[model samples]
Target chain A: MKKRKLFILIEGVDDKRFFEKIIKPRISSVYCSINIDTSAQTGNEKIRRYVKSFHKMGADYIFVTDLDEKACITKKKNDIHRKFRVRQDNIIIVVKEIEGWYFAGLSGKDINKLGIRGIINANTITKEEFNRIIPKQYESRLAFLLEILENYNIRAGKRNNESFCYFMNKYVSP
Target chain B: MKINKLIVKNYKTFNNLNISLDQFNVIVGSNASGKSNFLSIFKFLKDISFSGLENAIQLHGGPEYIKNINTKGNKNLSIELNIDFDIQPRLVLSMKPDDQLKENERFEGLGMTFKELKYKFEISFNSSRKYKVINEDIKFKGDLSKLTVGESQKIKEDEFHKGSTITFSRDPSGKVTFKTGAIQHFIKSMKHTQLPILPMQFVKVKHTELFLLEKAQELGLSILPPIATTIQNISSYDFDCKASKTATPISVRNTLESDGSNLPIVLKRVLNNPDTKKQFYSLIRDCLPFIDSYKTRPLLDKSIMLEVKEIYQSQYLPSLLLSDGTISITAIIIALYFENNSLIILEEPERNVHPALVSKVIDFMKDVSETKQVIISTHNPEVVKYAGQENIVFISRNKKGNSIMTAPKNNEEIQVFLENELGIEELFIQNLLT
Candidate 1:
């Protein structure tokens, strides 16, 4: 039997790096038979425009985006589902922001190693607030964050960050 | 003959890449992305046949510079070409390491190994780097089972060769008849010491063969003539119209040089023919409406000067005084109109011309491509508008910095963008095509 081809389209470089480096290594063995590919759309609007075309080309897709100001995650996913003919389960919306998820995953020891001296809460932390804890560079803050995560060996998933782990196990797993 | 596919390995910027060729191909890419390297493959083959492998490699800055830096373990560079004729035949050439050459050898050239069983030839090199043919298997195409017992036995006996394949002599008494004309012509062409077999060489061969040519029409192999003609007719032009204005010494050259240094001489030949001159004038007028006529005059120094006349002016102005755009446009028109049924590769034809006239230049190129093959490397998006998405091949660098060639049909997102959202030029401008 042949496994179906899968393509995952993400919002920006940060989302792409997280999925490729962090989540993929953990679940790749389970879906080894399927051909999986990833591409970054650079913005939310580009993803919305290209998602339908990608689906028409006989590819199952997993779309990942950050819910910046949306009050409810379900509402954002439902909105995307209505606009495009994508399945509801295929869309993963990071709650509050992607940086919030990173902050949620970091422990006290990891924070000290990352050179942060203050206390931070994951649920309400904005991107700006996270940047204050660990200053983000102009080039790419997510890339810097990803490097910190790898260096500290801080695992990111359901146990560490609730939304990220839920999206991975629900949509990305075999 | 038409080339269907090319597979290159360990070549500069192309580490294991395969490209498909069409009648008309326009390669688009950023600088240093390997568009010029792709076209150089044809020139390289012609060079090997003309000057042998060693000189060709030397001309390209030696083996170390030509091989891809990213290649691991194997240093051998190989190129395989699939050509389409009545019967398809593939030609493979591999460049071996020079260390294999014997210590006693004086001439240390690049070691080349070639094989083509259909042509009954296998070429290798000795320690001295001199070319040697190890095998020459001459057999007819089609069904061998149809041959009689005597014919089959005769062919088997004739297949035994212990010397150079080029020296194979046919026995008159043998029952097996072979098509040897094309191969003979190829050998004769190779004997001439030149970097590339030019158009004049083909003309000389045709003139000499017209008298002794037996079997009248089909004496030679069917594929060789077309292949040789394509090679002879292959012309590349990087126009320098400013240089065209200066008086050039008289020369008996028929084809235009890579630089347009021989422009006046070639244009003089074109003007001598009534039909070609009329076509040339019309093409030039189409691109630049203000031009009235063109003529050449002999200078006191026994050189020739090109002069052009405007519609309102009575006196003719020297071609040097013409605008750069006009001179460039005229040179291109002359080349396209005069070089019939030949492959012409142009580099950046959009330079020094008005944006509006760029489409006209592309239209002329497309029109000529109906009878010939035209490959252009360009950065101008306007050329894409006229050439369309199917004719364009995007050359881009991968993550590893190696050049990757892709057509719109093979890239899903590009295909979608062309189908639903925007034209190819629009996508290119938006950086989506890459």
Candidate 2:
């Protein structure tokens, strides 16, 4: 069977890192090609053109964005629809931001290895909060992010964040 | 001095060629289409200055290889260069022991007040397998031969005769002559050795000699040494990553070799200077952001090695452990910052470099070209994109197998195509530009 081609629109470099290092391996067999556009959020005009072009080329695409400070998931989805003409079904909203997804994958033992403080809820963790909780032993934020990704626990990720679990159930199979 | 024009005849794949050059040039061509051969011309002149002509020819795979095989008869090779002096050169008087005292007492040296120079030379082989000079000339917009050092005060007060030609020629009979307006008086004042003529003893001047300019410098003539020195300063490189990884001896750190074997020592020189050191590290950050700092250490055997510290790593990684891309880029940066050549030729600078890093490297080369001439040969479209189509020189071959070069600035069709919003590389890859 010929595998389907899927394009994932991402906000920035951090999202690219998450998809490439953490999420790509689990969903590799589902798509013949998976192109993660890290700079998809650069402008609404470019994103609109990309969405239309990909649709015309007979390729499926999913737009992923953070629901930060929005009243609800519906408001975030509506915002993307108005800005880029993307459909609600095609938009996948993270609970707060992609940085929180890094924390969603950490197990109790993984947290111990990271030498960080206790986390109350991974889905509620914003980018700023994650920065504050990063261990001082790491020289750079990139180093800390890489260390977390190196030992990422996908099963724990689906169990911790509702949005993450929804995304995995719809797009990936265990 | 920057060479503004070059004319090559009966050399390699070039039957007859003339091209105008700008400060920055990016030459593109398929494999063996003459990009490297074009770059080798500058290297050939440089080699002729340091190692003599025969050795330079040997280094380039011998006389037969350099001469164009397509030439029917009298297989002679000729090169002509037109140089623009950024500033007028100050002439130094090299007088006889008896005249030295008179020069100091009576004359302060004069300047060769010219704005442009044209130097040309041709060579042919004799039956003995030795190269012989068939013709040579150096013409410039200055009159050095009109002034005699004995009457320097009078000559200085008198206005200089400008727009004159100094001609050095050798006929097919092997007779050499140096002629210009009022040159008889100038030749009368100088000794037999410094008369700008090859002596009877050197009648069979070996193939391993630059008979005109180098000989003038050797004989310490007042006008030609500075020009010869400028030609000798030309350097070209295709840096070898493996050579750069090895340790270099402490004594040989003067200039970065063509292969970049002495990169550690050259980098050390850059670090010693505060301004270049800052620029070097900042450029490195732009190219390889993960690298935080670098240092050099001496081996036990009086040699040195280079090591770099990654952004979050506590230990410094030796060059041997570093990636090929990292070392090659580092060597390029060192060459740009520390090497003091008037003209620098880089062959395939994009080799081993990731596509992400090409922009910074090209930008740096463009920036450096402001002070000196930079010529690069590459096949990468990203390089062509960043270098801009206006700076491109496209080389191809003809039915006769001779190389044909076309600069986009000189081609009307290429200019019209460049006006479009589409990238020039798109057209280049489609073979439309040809």
Candidate 3:
């Protein structure tokens, strides 16, 4: 069977970069010769058109957008369902901007280490001050955080923290 | 013509790859994979080298030819053939700056424009003449004479009239031109045929007689068991193949075209040439070790027939013999006697011959074709086993037609694969396990 292509849309370039460096590389471990093209900016009109174009390019659309007030403010377009509804099985929406959303994705031993504070946010900080939170390790910290979400299998879901952890240990957890 | 090297850039499966050939090189790949394409790449290079870019481009359809890549994701294409030694040289070529990546521009107007190369170890250019010749980094102006090596022969400055069929090289300063026929002959001589042997169906056998006969004699012959050796002279002079009618027989000869189509004529030719005939008979006697008399005669109007003396059922059967046995023996003899000065590719020589005789058949081909590079693509593991260590090319395929040919890393791998796997076709299954 011809493998379905994965199309990704992000809230910003940072999302695209993060997913490429963190998520995509991890996904590549399980797949081979697959289409995983990505675009960014969740609610922007330009990004919507880009999403439609990628769908035309044979992608099973995925939206890794932030679920903050900015996304809530943008008006919804009409063709969102007509184009994206083609393949329901491969569609996914990831809400990654809430304060505790990153840690809300963790559970078990993962939660014990990273604690309730969630991933220390750097979005509000200026470029120079952004390093103040993690201070030393960059990739290792990112890997540790994402490993939490992957462990729960809720990286693509918004409200699946406790329930997702239950589903994770049931189906996906090693 | 002997090729020196094939430099490929973003060409299909090969990304910036260059293959060097010394006399002979065998390429193996899985089904639907790209071995033939690689060979055709050589063909395309030959076509483009002499045909002028315009005609060659048109014949290939368009820039699409250059833009079609394999799994390596390289669609853009460029190839450089260091062919001065292969057929012609004394030249170099490159695209003009603006058209570096454009195909139509490369072939615009007065046809395809290839950078003209020169042999003099100096760089010179004439903007008015639309040329820039330089010391070979591999670059040059459009000088055609210094193309062939040694005594540069003059070619009648044809404007790629024959396209890849032939092209001449020249030296403008010295008014020298290289001959193009040598290359033409090489192109014409490629092996083209596929029956029980090769799955692909086109290989050309060049014309070489005396040398091939001597080689075949060295390979030895096969003597069949008396009763099993029967002849059916069915190719009659008046038998209309279209009408399915049977008549008398035609004469048999001693040489075979690549297809073995003119097998009868080959028998006749052997009879006519005393030295070759003696070699043919003596070798067959040595290998078979059976008391036999063989002769060929031309029938009245249009055909040939063969007469062979053999012991059958304690009696004798002459002229009327077993076709399968005869054909197998005849093919080996013809292969040895008729192929020379080039590579000989055999399909399956293991057809009707018994398993015991297979080694002899292989040995015959090896003796005859080895000196000139014999390449055989076979499915019979016995043939592979008999070929042993030095010669063998394993083939397999991936989802993409791009082929991956690894030189076994070591022969032990092949041995292990053989001892472990079912057949070559099933070897790829190990990849899934890996």
Off by over 4 Å in 3: A1-174, B1-255, B285-291, B313-325, B351-353, B409-434
Q: Which model, 2 or 3, shows the larger TM-score? A: 2
lDDT of 2 by residue, B244-358 (tens): 9888899994688999888889888888889988988898888999998889999999999999999889999988899989998998887776678888789998898999889
DockQ, all candidates in order: 0.09, 0.02, 0.01
Once fitted onto the true fold, the runs of candidate 2 whose alpha carbons sit more than 4 angstroms away are A1-174, B92-111, B126-130, B143-161, B182-208, B222-225
Docking class of 3: incorrect
Clashes of each: 5, 0, 52
Interface Cα RMSD in Å, per prediction: 5.7, 10.7, 20.2
Q: Residue B4 error for model 1, in Å?
A: 3.7
Task: Compose the digit string of candidate 3's lDDT tens values, residues B1-434.
Answer: 33345566544454445554443233444445555455445434334334533344446554444433453332335455443222233221111233332443222111112232211111122223122222112222222211111223332232332232123122323222223333334323322111111111122211111111111122221110010011010011111111111112344333344445455566666767788778887767655656365555556777555555554444434334544555556656666555343434454545455666667767776676434444454455556546543454544443454444444424343344344322433333222111
Residue B159 of candidate 3: its Cα lDDT?
39
Cα lDDT tens digits for candidate 1, B327-421:
77877877777865367778777777898999899899889877667788887888877787888998877657788888876777667655555
User: Which segments of model 1 are wrong by more than 4 Å?
Assistant: A1-49, A94-174, B5-20, B28-34, B64-229, B237-335, B347-359, B378-385, B392-434
DockQ score of the complex predicted as candidate 1: 0.09
lDDT of 1 by residue, A1-174 (tens): 454445565655565556666666665554522223233423444444556666566556677667878888888988878766567878877866777666666666766765777666565678788777664332566566766556533343355566766775676552
DockQ of 3: 0.01
Q: Which ten residues in a row have the lowest lDDT in candidate 3 chain B?
A: B225-234
**Highest lDDT against the true fold, candidate:** 2
Candidate 1 scores a chain A TM-score of 0.73
